[model samples]
Target chain A: MKYATMRIISGAGERTLATITEVRSIAALFLHALHGCFRPSRALSASFFAQISRQILYTGVEAMGLVGIIAFFCGVTIVLQSMTTMPQFGVTEYFGNILVVAVVREMGPFFTSLVVIGRSGAALAAHIGTMRVNKEIDALEVMGIDPVHFVVVPALAGMTLSMICLNCYFDMIAIVGGLVIANVTVQVPFGIFLGKVLDALSWIDIVLSSSKGLVFGAVIAVVSCWYGMAVNNIRAVPQAAIRAVVGSMTVTIILNIVATVGFYAR
Target chain B: MPVKLEIDGIFWSAGVFPLLRGISLTVERGEIMVIGGRSGCGKSILLEICAGLKRPERGRIVWDDIDIATMSRNELLTARQRIGYVFQQYALIANYSIFENIALPLRSRGDLAEKEIDVRVHTVMEEVALFNVEKHFPESLSNGQLRAAALARALVTDPEMLFLDEPVSGLDPQTASGIRAVLHARQRRRERTIVTICHDLYLWASRPHRVAVLEGGKLVEPEENHAFRQMVEARR
Candidate 1:
């Protein structure tokens, strides 16, 4: 029994090591491909443009309706919650600033990344996973075109650009809705609320939030592509795609926390 | 034509199960070499190994005296450009238009001008008689059209060797015959070496310069045309 237990433990250790090695290799492949994208290759350029168009369609246009509705409701809810609390503090005028800081600086990029992970990220994984399973990656290699240059670079470029654009749209709508809500519900003057928001909104906040958006976009694209390429079985593609989305969302939230702390640490 | 490919003592496996065990074969340029076996007989695996898509556990695949098994990944890729592969499911990029699908390899080549790419794509599409459907996506195409588009994509590179995996597996007889005719025509025109996996013995026997039989992941004896037919008929 002692011998058997040791054998089992050793087997498990070896399996874990193999998994870690595979993950490391995949991460290396992603970074290598990321660098390869900027190396002035003609194949990479065509794929990059193709991916940019796809990203615009998948991440920006498809997301507008959902983001718009969510932003409106978020504004409305923040106003309702603030009206109840601000009266207690006698600082009802600060509602617009609060909404702008919460929604624009924090919530907008976070929720947009979440939505994209669910929609476009999952689709990207599924599409690429299917390609891998069907030996299209091998086909690309056979044609002397790196799959990273042809497939992955374009996707990363497109998603990064799209995420930034989507977050910008989300911020605009949420802030406008918040101002309208403050005017109607709190009876705060719209001009005063707008002035406070503009004063309170820092360029640092926008830059940090957009930077986070870009990082999250890269994480989502890389994770999905890695999962897609790593899967061997056709039935495993969906599971890999789901894992990519869930893993990316969880990592994004954690990174968001770290970024928030780092930004406000001073 | 001279022998352009030689496989010596190839060994491959799918996980724990050995797929190709000490398999060896050779193909001369302009020859059609048919590998006939029942499903799961490792014929496709052999083709993939030959095409440098799969690495073997042991053995050497020499293409014109170059040992492909020992080449670097990029070198293997460059070697692959000289070989065309027609996948079992046609494997046309579904999102791309038929023309774009054919144009993909050329774009990757980075050698052809836009006009030249267009001309090559058009000529190949015409050769496969798929010029009329060039603008359509793979989803819009029928099985026959899809296979032809795939063939056109494979042929556009002007590969010296073509590897086909069950090219007519799921097609209707009419469509299958049409594909075979297109392949036959191309063979007549270019004299390219063709390596194909098929269970349809009669179809293969009619065209092949040589036939190899694989059973239980091992090549059986007597690899001549007459012996191959007799063995297939005996199995039937």
Candidate 2:
């Protein structure tokens, strides 16, 4: 039993070290890719622009419906739960504020990032991992092209741009869902619900939420790119995908927490 | 101008396993040298090291009197820009059309107008005997056509030097000969220095200027270049 316990501990320590190494590599790749973009030749290339457009279409345009549906349902559920529980506590007057704060500040960024992590982050890792194993990265290097410039920058730009737009859209639609619930179930006027939500929301909320979306998008791109370029075998591709998704999601959640506390901690 | 390339006492290893030991060679301007070896004999590794994609553990690769190993990042990029490398697997971007793949090197320079890029790429395509397949992706190409496209991409920039790894190893005889003919024509026309890694020796109907063999982790010149030249001169 003692031997087994020691083995488990050792394994966990090795895993922790490996995770740190991975994070360092991802951060390095992110910085290098950003540096690559500062060179006008790389940043202004038709290939780079084309890659950005494709990524936008994939991560932003294709995922719009999924983000909307999830946001609307999330809003409706929160409103319903608050309506039932808050009235018993006689705090129902604060429901509009609760919904506005939660949906706009938290749910909007969290849900949109989760969608991109699942849909695009995994795909990014898998694609890059396959290319690494196949010597495509080596091919690029020999051709005097940095793979980071060709692969990661566009992904970074696409995810950030998409997430910011999607978060705003999610917030808007989610409020509509809450207004719908307010009008039909609670017998409140649509104008009242809209006015209350608008009152509770501030430019600060948009700024905070947009910043969260941008940071989360960058996290996903860097983590995905790092894992993807780390593969050496066929088995490693699936492993890379899993790690990329988990790492990006973890980073996003941690960033969300810190941002939340930093904004509200008075 | 075609620059002189020198590989001086290069040593490389894979973990504890030594792959290349004290391998040295000199490739003169406007000449072709084919390095032949068995499987896993570090043929590709040597090519990659010479291309500046991989650094040798111990040795200096002097390209036109500048040691590539000590060059800065931008210097390395500048050096690589003057050379073209063709991988055995073609390595064409699967999502890109043939025209785009061929135009990639030119596009990366960021100075060529679209018309210049189109003209140079099409001219190289014609040189490689590839026509009307510009819109097709790499996945849709035949083995021979893919090899042609790879060669076209390598030559489209009019690089001063060209390196190919197992370029014709997997193609049919007719297609293999066709590729060889195109390579020879390009070399003669452009005076581009060429280094090829080959597994099969029987296919060299038009033998290169020199033949070097990688064996026992060292590059050995067969003295065939001198002997073959003498024999040809004797015949003439």
For candidate 1, the docking band is medium
For B159-227, candidate 2 gives per-residue lDDT tens digits of 899999998988888878888888888788878899999866445636688788788798776454444
lDDT per residue as tens, model 1, B1-236:
32388898999888899888899888888889888877787888899888888878899989989998778877876677788889887777767788888898888778888899899999988877785888898889888788888888898988888899888888888778877887877788889888888877677666888877787777774354455667667867
Query: Which candidate leads in lDDT?
Result: 2
In model 2 chain A, where is the ten-residue run with the lowest total lDDT? Answer: A36-45
DockQ for every model comes to 0.55, 0.50
Cα lDDT for residue A228, candidate 2: 96
Q: Candidate 2's residue-wise lDDT over A27-48, tens digit each? A: 8988887786566354247888
Which regions of candidate 2 deviate over 4 angstroms? A1-18, A38-44, B222-236
Q: Pick the candidate with the highest DockQ.
A: 1
lDDT of 1 by residue, A1-266 (tens): 99999999999999999878866875786796688667746744564576679777987788999988888878778777887888799886677678877887799889899988998888888888898887778777767777877777777878888888888888878877877887786577878877887887888878977898888888888877777877777998998889889867877899899988887796
Q: List the residue pairs that clash in candidate 1.
A: none
Backbone clashes in each candidate structure, one number apiece?
0, 0
Q: Could you give the interface RMSD of candidate 1 in angstroms?
A: 1.6
Per-prediction TM-score to the true structure, in the order listed: 0.90, 0.92
